[model samples]
Target: MQRYFVAPEQFRGVIITITGEDAHHAARVMRMKPDDQIIVCDGVSRSVRAVVLEASPQEIRAEAEEELLQDSEPAWSITIAQGLPKADKMELVIQKGTEIGASSFVPFESERVIVQYDGKKEAKRIERWSKIAKEAAEQAHRHRIPSIQPVQSWRQMLTLIGEFDLALFCYEREGAAAHGKGIANAVRQWKLEREKSSDEVVQNPRIVLLVGPEGGFSEREAVEAEAAGAILVGLGKRILRTETAGLVGLTCLLYESGAMEGA
Candidate 1:
C-alpha cells in the first residue's frame, strides 16, 4: 500500500484530509480513487490504515480503518556530529542518513575542515539539507523526519558532549589500541550494560557519533574531543574519505546497536 505523511491537524476522528503537494500527487500523479487503500502518517505519533473516501483536484480525504504502528523510527536515537566537508557531500550525507534512521545531524567546523560556513551560506545550506531530509524520510516510510541543524563551531560541539549517553569520535590518526576496539566493541558494551540493568523499563540510549572532514581531525582537535568526553575510535586499517567515513561508521553503529532491525 502507498503511504503519505500528513499533519496531525489534518486528521479529525477517522477522516484525514491531505492537501498541497500530497493532494496533487494523489489526484494527478497517482490518479487514486475512492475506496483505494493507503497508509497515512500524521507526521507525529499516529499512522492509520486508511481508504480513500473522497478524491478531488484540490484535496484527498481518507477514512481511517485502523491505527497502525509507526515504522519509520529506529529503536535507538543516533545523532551524527560530522565535521563539515567540502562541496556537495553534505547533501548526500543528510539524505542517506535520514533513510538509515539518523535522528539528528550537526555539522561542525573542525580545525582540519577547509569548508568555512559564514552565516548566510550556513542558512542556505541548512535549508537545502532540510528539504533533502524531508524527502528522504518520506521515501523511506519513516514516521518522523530527521532534522539538519545549522553548522556549529568546535566550541559549540564541545558543549554538546554530555547530551548523549554514548559518544564515539572516529579518529584515523589514533594509535593501534584505538583501532582494536572498533565500533562493534562500543555497541557490545552498551548492550551488555542494558541487559545487566535490573530496571524493568528499558532506557532509550542516545548516541553521538562524530566524523571528521576531508583532511581528518588535527591532533589538537582529536585531543580536545577526547577531553570533552568523546571516545576516539577507529574504523579500520584503510583511510576513508570524509564523505564515506561517517556513513560507514553510522551503518556499523546502527546495525550493532540493533537500531536497523525491524524498523
Candidate 2:
C-alpha cells in the first residue's frame, strides 16, 4: 500500500484531508482514484490505514479504517551528533540516518571540520536538510520524521551530551577497546542489566552517537568528548569516510536496540 504523511489538523473525526505536495502527487502523479487504499501518517507518528474517499485537483480525502502502530521506531531514541562534513555529505547522512531510525540529527562544527556553515548560509543549509529528512521519512515508511537541528559548535555539542543515557564517540584511533565488540554487545549488556533489575522494559532510552568530520576530530577534541561523558569507541580497522561512519554506526546501534528487527 502507498503511504503519505498528513497534518494532524487535516484529520477530522474519521476523515483525513491530505493537502499540499502530497495531494498533488496523489491526484496528478499517482493518478489515484476513489476507494484506493493508502496509509496516512501524521508527522507526529500516528498512522491510519485509509482508503481514498474523494480525490480532487487540490486535495485528497481518505477515511480512516484502523490506527497503525509505529513499530519501525526503535525501543530507544538514538540521536546522531555528526561533525559537519564537506560538500553534500550532510544530505546523504540525513536520508540514510532517518531510514535506520535515528530520532534526530545534530550537525556540529568540530576543530578538524574544513567546511563551516555561517550566518544565512546555515539557515539555508538547515532548511534544505529538513526537506531531505522529510522525503527520506516518507520513502522509508517511517511514522515519525526525524529532525535536522541547526548546526552546533563542538563546545555546544558537549553541553547537549548529558540529555542522553549513553553517549558514544566514534574514533578511529581510540585505544580503549577493540572495535570487534559490535554495537549489539553494548545493547545486550544494557538490556541484560535492565532485565535483571525489573521485568519492565526501558522504552525510550536516549543514546547519542557522535561522528567527527572529514579530517576527523583532533586529539584535544576527542579528549574533550570523553570528558563530556562520551565513551570513545572504534568502528573497525578500516577507516570510513565521515559520511559513511555515522550512518554505519547508527544502523548497527538501531539493530542492536531492536528497532530494525521484525516484530
Candidate 3:
C-alpha cells in the first residue's frame, strides 16, 4: 500500500488531511482517487490505515480505517556524528544511514574535514539532507523519519557528547584492543547492562557514533574525543572512507542490539 506522512495537526478525530506536495503526488503522481486505501503516519510514531474520502487538486482527505502498530523502529536510538566529507558523500551517508535505522545524523567539522559550511548555504544544505532522510525512511517503511541536524563546529560537537548514553569514535589508528572490547563485544556489554537494570528502564538508549573525514582525525583530536567520554574503537584492519565508516558502525550496532537480524 502507498504511504504518506501527515503532520500532527492534519489529523482531526478520524480524518487525515494530506495537503501540499503530498496531495499533489497522491492526486497526480500516484493517481489516487476516493476510496483508495493508503497508510498515513504522523512522521514520528503514530500511523493508521485510511481510505481516501475526497481527492482534489488542493488536498486529499482520508478517513482512518484502523490504527496501525508499527514496530519497524529500532530498539535503540543511534545517532551518527559524521565529520563533513567532501562534495555529495554526506548525502549518500544520510540516505543509506536512514535505511539502516539510524535515528539521526549530525555532520561536524573535524580537524581533517575539507568541506566548509558557509553561513549563507548552511540552511539549504540541511534542507537537502532532511529531504533525503525523509524519502529514504518512507521507502524503507520506517515509522519515524530520522533527523538531519545542522553542521556543528568541533567544540559544539564536544558539548553534545553528554546527551548520549554511549559515544564511540571510529578511529582507524586504534585496533579493537583499544578498549579491550571490540565493537561487537562493547554493544553486547551495553545490552547486558540494559537488561540487568530493568528497574531503571533504559528504553531506547541513545548512542552517538563518530566518523572522521577522508584524512581522518588528527592525534590531538582523537585524544580530546576520548577525554570527552567518547570511546575510541576500530572498525577493522582495513580502512574505510568517511561515508562508509558511519554506515558500518551503525550496522554493527543495530545487529548487535537485535534490531537488524542476519540470515
- Which wins on TM-score, candidate 1 or candidate 3? 3
State the lDDT of candidate 3 residue by residue for 1-263, as single tens digits.
88888789999989999998889988999999999999889986689999999997689999999999888888889999999999999999999999999999999998888876687998999999988998888888888888988889999998899889998888887654544446776677767877787478677789999999999999898889888988887888777988999999999998887886753
What local lDDT score does residue 14 receive in model 3, on the 0 to 100 scale?
93
Q: Which scores better on TM-score, 2 or 3?
A: 3
Put the candidates in lDDT order, highest first: 3, 2, 1
lDDT of each: 0.83, 0.84, 0.88
Residue pairs in candidate 1 whose N, alpha carbon or C atoms collide under 3 angstroms: 72-142, 72-143
Q: Candidate 3, which segments miss by more than 4 Å at Cα?
A: 176-181, 192-201
Q: Which tens-of-lDDT digit does each residue in 1-263 have in candidate 2?
A: 88888778889989999888888989998898999999998878589999999997699999999999877767778899999888898899989988878889999998888985776788888888888888888888888888788888877999999878888888888523554444556557767887787566657788999999998888898789889988777777788999998988898887776666665
- Write candidate 1's Cα lDDT for 34-105 as tens digits: 999988887779988999999976999999999997755776789888898888898888888888888999
lDDT of 3 at 188: 72
What TM-score quantifies how close candidate 3 is to the native fold?
A: 0.93
Between candidates 2 and 3, which one is better according to lDDT? Answer: 3
Cα deviation in Å at residue 83, candidate 2?
Answer: 0.8
lDDT of 1 at 249: 84
